[model samples]
Target: MKKIHHAEASSYFIEAKDNEAFHDQRLWDLRQKRDREAAVIPEFQELRNLASQIKEHTLTHLAEYLEQFEAKAQANGVTVHWALDAAEHNRIVYDLLTDHSVRTLVKSKSMLTEECELRPFLERRGIEVIETDLGERIQQLDNEPPSHIVVPAVHKLRGDVAKVFARTLDTDPDNDDPNYLSEQMRVKTRHFFVDAEAGMTGGNFAVAETGGVVVCTNEGNADLSANVPPLFIASVGIEKLVPRLDDLAVFIRLLSRSALGSPITQYTSHFRAPRKSGEMHIILVDNGRSERLGMEEFWYSLKCIRCGACMNTCPVYRRSGGLSYGAVYSGPIGIILNPTHDMRKYSSLPFASTLNGSCTHVCPVKINIHEQIYGWRRVLAKHNQLPFVKKAAMKVAGKILSDPQKYRKTIDVADAAIEHLPRFLLYSRMNAWGRQREVPAPPDQTFHAWYLKNREGKQ
Candidate 1:
């Protein structure tokens, strides 16, 4: 597939003014909710700082903790698997299902599985992989990717959801009621719970000290998926591991409040091992995380807890929509992560941000997201990865900026053009900034000119 840059994709998103405004309002509501929730916690900033410190300590000593977790989990009868990359992770999961003769699998919300493209991977081989989470199931039925990590269908309206349900599951065509749709999905999802032979979930936190995979969900889908099936599998990023149960406590306090504006998620389940007779497996995926770790300036990106708070508060993300980034993850965090995961395909992501730093301010782990994005821009420029047009523009700009005479002459010409040219000419497609917005009115005179006139004789 040919890849389009964020700018081009977002242009299409911007065309939907109503949808864009609605999307912006919805995400901003979540941000406001987060702020309200945070206000009640007297030690919120302290909690975030503690979480950051714990993550840093754990990541630096990650290998030791992984070894410890593996040993403890096995002792608790939970089988552990390590995957060096996405292919390995998918293959490991497929092999497990095949070995157990599992023809049908039920899954909860798992961004890692989405990242690995697990549903299509298993489905291609005749395994009936079902997404049980309401938003995920809706997207799965519609054959679309998640628009937001926490709220998967935030880009969609209730009518769009009703239409999808009506078409795919044969629900009432006229009813767009939220409760009606949710009930229909609930009744339909229960069938997957009963028929599926295996279940899979994504980990919110992996407690290395106790070898438990913690999953937080509002819908209780993760619990249902894990308990009803005879086989359970969890796919977790390497970054999800924490040093101890106490560290997990710190994150648990921040995750839901930041992501959903709740004190805590409704169901925070911990799976250490399978029930009496069932089997449990944990697949720890690297998927370029180790490589990302080696980038000293950007290693802190791994501390993210997938809370999605940064996206909620991001001005650019609010307007652009998640699909604009063209990656599994989106928003300020995605701008840093996607390029680090694969720079060739995602090199345009860093340019998606406005560098307002609101993302960094709202991050539960304090990842310095905006700064990392700025750093990635330098990396891209260093490797000549920038577009030819942008490079040429920068070179010309640099030349003009280096000489005062050239700068003054250019400013004078621009001022004259702005003052004399017709709007149609000045705001045409040739002028990139003017294409989206009206050209700024020309200043009465250049700042330099005014300064020279007003201050030259002051002494």
Candidate 2:
């Protein structure tokens, strides 16, 4: 597998000045809003703590809670299925759709289904899958993966969206008004809500106590997707389960505030059973989550609620774009999560962060994302998964740092190179850092030399 070259991939997003400027500022604005909303709530941090603890407890006792959830869901007239991996997850959904004679499926925004690549799977088999969420539908029409989790098409400007709609939805390309675009999207998708044979959703939180799947959205598409179709399906990641309904209060408070700085979503629909006289199915998907749960350094990442808080606050993600990660999940969370699934394919992802810890600080679940990224780097190095150049450089760095004389000599050489190297040599393509910035001029004197002069070699 070709390793994900994040720098090379992100160059495209960065080169687009208008899109890059908007993407960076828009996400940072959301981060500011998150901070403001968090400040007003006295118990915000406490809720995060409680939510983290609850998730830890639930994960440790996952089998018991899963069994309880299955029993209760079955009791409530919902057919519950389990998937061990992505292939099984896809097979189960396909079998279910075929068994029910479902030709067309209308689906709400579902990251789990995206992870399973369900749309392409079913479409290849001649089943039509329509995305109902505004952002997801735009991305689907564009034939691109979402650039951000909460705001999938965030990298696109209104003009770009208008262009997309003009090409596909046949909207007036000159009419780029937000309201007009939204209305056009609504008008186009309204029929699918009624005409589709099946509708699918992904749950934000699953309550083991009540056997209910909770979906929170600003748009009410999930509501329509779950309620309008005679055959309803929800694909839930196994990590979404909570021990009881009361535990929902903590996450409910944090999800919106952390994600979009809203007090709550416009619609927080709870699906406990099928619509009257309709059939409901819930697929509790593992898809490498069980393996992640067993990992010592990385398991707590499962505490994620899919709120996109870390992505909003991540400077690297804001600049690089989610598509740069080349995974269903992106940003800080993806750095650690993607490698677990395919180390060779995603090894470069772990090194894509600046380790600023803004993602961890902003995460409602307090995932310690930067630390996990660091851990992934170490693990990748140990497993020989790092790029050959990086691996060799790191090996040299390790040797130099282990010996004081060698380290000092290397620093001296670097200082000389910085001061005397010609611009042509220093700013060449080989120097990735110099692409966007010139290497800083050599210091007036090396810090090491200054230290020696001041302390008179006391050590």
Supply the TM-score for candidate 1: 0.95
lDDT of 2 by residue, 367-391 (tens): 8899999999889888988777666
Model 2 regions lying over 4 Å from their true place: 408-430, 443-459
lDDT of 2: 0.89
- Tens-digit lDDT string for candidate 1 (105-199): 99999999989998999999999988988888888989999988998888888888999999999998789999999999999889889999999
Error of 2 at 328 (Å): 0.6
Give the CA lDDT, 0 to 100, for residue 201 in model 2.
96
Whole-model Cα lDDT of every candidate shown, in order? 0.89, 0.89
Report how far off residue 149 is in candidate 2 (Å): 1.5
